[model samples]
Target: MRKPRWWAELALIAVVYAAYSGGRILVKGGEASAVEHGLAILRFEEGLGIDAEHPLNRLFTSVPALGIPADFAYASLHYLVTPAILVWLFRRRPAHYRAARAWLMTATLLGLVGFTLFPTCPPRLLDAAHGFSDTMAHFSAYGWWGGEASAPRGLGGMTNQYAAMPSLHVGWALWCGVMLWRYGRTPLAKALGVAYPLVTALVVMGTANHYLLDAVAGVAVMGAGPLLAPYVLRLVDRLRETAEASPVVSAGCETSAGERIPGQRSVRTTADDKQEWGLPCSSEAESLGKAR
Candidate 1:
């Protein structure tokens, strides 16, 4: 595979992120429906006895130390660490970068679809009697986020508060974790690979920004990414190949003789083609002609 250029990769990421953000803003599900879906998820989790949001939220809020940092993490790390890891892969593990990047972009687009289809409210937005608190709201004064999700203080209105199902926060953390663990050579990197996702899951739950099911859905989304990424990569390759294979003249005249050569076409031979055909390259052909 050809090595990807940093600028091109950056532009691709920026465009994808802009699309994801714009999709989230546009799919603002109705408040009543969002809450109902949130309740449904809560009931489902409770039936399975995995309703961890309440307890986690209470623990985070009751202690400022835990609550403040968790809020910061919920608001910032989702934006920060993912890109940092992408840069790390580009610089340190170039061979693995393309596949990893494709996987992440595919998963992110999948997340946008989930957000569009299932815009469930977060645990924090449910009824107060549900026993879940919005730790981000509680600790808003300590950080840049406001009463609304993790958007900036006054800019909170710009974000879609109800797009909580299949939390991309957890999904991205899982992606980052996998990249680090798979490509990172050091023990610390592997250890971080395990710890990062677990911590992010806890942070999202503890902050009441996502339900346990949302985190599970996020994991499921990440799982689906790898399976779909190869196809995406292949499609991109085909498009690139098509663009590169522009039409060439089918026949051309020899300037010296001024005669047309039928069935002769102008084609650029790649190194692989020369190897496969066992043919001398242009330079070698020239050297042989001179020797003759």
Candidate 2:
């Protein structure tokens, strides 16, 4: 297979970002439904005995210094780390690039679908009675983001605050982890692959940007992507092979009585009477010539 071009990859990344941002804005108006879904998720977490988001947020926010870093992780690392790892994979491990890229895109698009369909609000956006503090707000002056989530202060109104289900921050962090762990040559690299995602999962929950269940869904989506990609790729390969093998029907090269004749192939014998069927193999053509 041909290697991917740098310009094409850059363009594809830009397009994907544009689509994600635009889709989030378009599907973000369902506030009441989002709140209900977020509440339902919290209740479901309690039922499953994994209600950690609230306490995590409370603990982290109790320490402003710790909360600042967690907020930074949510706002910046979620956006930066995935793309950086993707570029590294593309350049360093071309053989693994296609499958990894497919998995990432599939998981991310699935997250978009969840954002549109479920539209769960984040813990920070929940009622003040919930005791959830918006850590990003508390540390907004330290970073580029506004009092809300990671959007710029001026552009905060344009972002999708309610699109919180299936937390992509955690999902992307996990992707980075998988790539580093699987491909890294050193012990430190492997350790980072495991640590980064774990840190991101905690950071998202601690910053009130995602629920425990949302991070769970994110991991589930990432897991499903690789499982489904192989089948989809196999189907595509079959279709491509079928297309290449199918005969190409066209008008005959020679004319008869000023009209084209059908059933005649485009290939012809050479001037030396050597049979050629538009293929370049001399031994095969010699066999055809002898058969003729």
> How much does each candidate deviate from the true structure in C-alpha RMSD?
5.7, 5.5
Query: Where does candidate 1 stray beyond 4 Å?
Result: 248-292
Would you list the C-alpha lDDT of every candidate in the order shown?
0.87, 0.83
Kindly list the per-residue Cα lDDT of model 2 for residues 91-158, writing each as its tens digit.
Answer: 99989997898788878888899999999999999998977999999888899998879988888888
Per-residue lDDT of model 1, residues 1-292, tens digit only: 7889999999999999999999999999999999999999999999999999888989999999899998988889999999999999999989888999999999989998998898899999888999988888887888887899888889987899999989889999999999889888999999999999999999999999999999999999999999999999999999987776654322231222323346566454455755554443346443443464
Top candidate on lDDT is 1
Clashing pairs in 1: none
Q: Report how far off residue 42 is in candidate 1 (Å).
A: 0.6
Flag regions of model 2 displaced more than 4 Å: 234-292
Lowest lDDT block of 10, candidate 1: 249-258
Q: Estimate each model's TM-score.
A: 0.86, 0.82
